[model samples]
Target chain A: MNSEQQNATLRKMAQLMRDGLKTQTEPFPETEKEFAAILEELRRLDPGDLEGKMVISGFVDHPYGPDRQRCMECMYYLVHRQWCDLPELAVPVEADWWCRLWRI
Target chain B: MANLLWLQGGACSGNTMSFLNAEEPSACDLVTDFGINVLWHPSLGLELGENLQKMLLALTSGQMPLDIFVFEGTVVNAPNGTGEWNRFAGRPMRDWVTDLCKVANFVVAVGDCATWGGIPATAPNPTESEGLQFLKRDHGGYLGKDFKSKAGLPVINIPGCPAHPDWITQIVVAVATGRGGELSLDEFQRPKTFFTSFTQTGCTRNMHFAYKVSATEFGQRKGCLFYDLGCRGPMTHSPCNRILWNRQSSKTRAGMPCMGCTEPEFPFFDLAPGTVFKTQTVMGVPKDMPTGVDKTGYIKLTAAAKAASPRWAEEDIFVV
Candidate 1:
């Protein structure tokens, strides 16, 4: 997507989180198999189902744990693009935002 | 001339294919230039039946000098330790290996199989396969831990899935040229010269590795494979990047993760599901850290690197 399109999507996602979208933020995937299962769930979603993607992936607006794990430290995060680069969860995200699919 | 005898056990002859492709000091150069006498090789040997048996007998009985005995596969002792499962030249190959190793000046374990029982010795090993001097990380494989060649050195292991072509030939040349005593070996008995460096030492993607930008998929050309793709280059001890496979590229250079084939615990996690290409993590942190790095340091490094990563690191800078 172009810079304009990405910004619009980013704004929409930010607004949804701000409006208190109840995403699955508990039972964070602790292993690759669990993480893979979540990716499999994301794969079965409609391409445009952004809300479903956020819900299943356990997206949280703020850093989630004692270590405060977030998108900035995730291996799949593209820092400059403000995006999650994971193939299953390719979506715009703030650096402070997090999801269960996060890995360093 | 140095008499070199190459034998196969529970193997696929992949090492023989690799040895034939050696270029730095080609296989032909061993005979033509380095004065290595090819007594017999499974692929190159002309002798068959009684002739091969007679030659093997001569070497074992001390009638002929066996300068270098090169082994290419795991020593199989199956169906209750008789080694009949992998018979060769009228007897079990392991029997021949035992006899030849006792008299040979230098014994070289050529590939991962012979060095540390490669795939054949993995869990539920029906063949009861084992390496010359090691089984996985443990000492004492088919040969006892204290076993040594006539030269008083343990098996000089040149390990890889099919050890790099030059690694096999060059070490052969070293032993053939009577410089075998000068060779230093690691705890695993691999030549220190080749196994001292990590595969990540000279990698082109090192910049991306430093920036903590992971390549999420194969052949991505932009990021390092370590963080997401189960690359063992950081912990693997091999000069893969320095020596360069086929004189051009390595596994990581081609965007395939280094499988850590040279290390003893190869086929790591015993080929467990979802473990091959996917980095194993615990609580979202890498299960195996880079050599000498702890979890806290890795986590801190990742955060700093991600923040400091230049814009170009996230882009495909390798424009074709």
Candidate 2:
């Protein structure tokens, strides 16, 4: 998909979370093993399953937890492109949005 | 002529191999150009059995002047501290080390084993091995903290898995040419000249590092290895980038992470499961920030660096 398609999918993800989509957000991965487990889960899902990717990754439209971490500060975030550069979760995202995979 | 004796104990003979690959002021240059009389070396020496023992005895007895003593492994005190596990010319290698170190004008510990016990001295050290002057971060190993050579200097540690060839040959030339006293050493006894810089000093991926782009996979041709991959270049002290291995490229340059082999705590985390190539994180932040950086500053820097990152920073811009 092109950049425009990716942006549309990201917007739909935000809408899903806003419309009371209960996602697994608690028990943040505190170790590499935990982090990798989450990635493994995302990897096992169908590549076309954008909603499953968002739900499983615990997408939030704003900064997260006590640290107020966001995609803007994430190592995998591309600021200019407004995209998540993770190979497993290739989706455009807003600067303020966050997910369980969020890492600085 | 300056007499140099090279020996090994509890080692894999890695440093000896690295020494043979020296090219800058080559190994042959040490004898031909630098006027160094190679008294004996584990690989290059011509003596055998009793002949080798006599040479070692001569140096210990002060009958033959010992200019430089180069040890390239650990001092094993295993099998009830008898040191019999690693026997040398006549007795336990440790005994020979004790005698040789006393008379030599300069004592040089080549490679990590001789410098900081390396892998053999890792936790549950079965061989009870130790470096000449240090066991990991501890100051005193087989030698006491106050121990110094005849020249009044502590054991000069040239640390690395095997240490770069030039690092070994260059230091040897300096010592053989009466410049040994001028050489300054860091707290780890590594030459300050080479140990002062980080392995990341000349890394080609600095742009990716500055932009906070993570190189998720190996040999990606772009992105920094410090983020997703466990690269110790920013914290590791070495001239790997500046000196260039094989006179061409370093590990970082060739898309490999700096293993931080030169550091005393190398094979970091005792080769823990899941710690090798993966960056350790806590609460979504790196467990170990670059050398002196704290978490708060890192977050702010990432936010800014990420925001300021150009279009090229996110893509593989290295052209063929």
B-chain TM-score, every candidate? 0.99, 0.98
Instruction: Show where candidate 2 strays beyond 4 Å.
Output: none
Give lDDT per model, in order: 0.93, 0.91
**Cα lDDT of model 1 by residue, A1-104, tens digit:** 88898899889998999999999987888899998888899999997899999999888899988988889899999999888889887888999999988888
RMSD of each: 0.7, 1.6
lDDT of 2 by residue, B56-118 (tens): 999999999999999999999998899999998869999999999999999999999999899
Model 1 per-residue lDDT at B61: 98
Q: Write the per-residue lDDT of candidate 2 for residues A8-70, one digit (tens) a residue.
A: 887788788788887778778989888899999999999988888888888888898887888
**Model 1: CA > 4 A from native:** none
Residues forming the 10-long window of minimal summed lDDT in candidate 1 chain B: B213-222
Which candidate comes out best when scored by DockQ?
Answer: 1
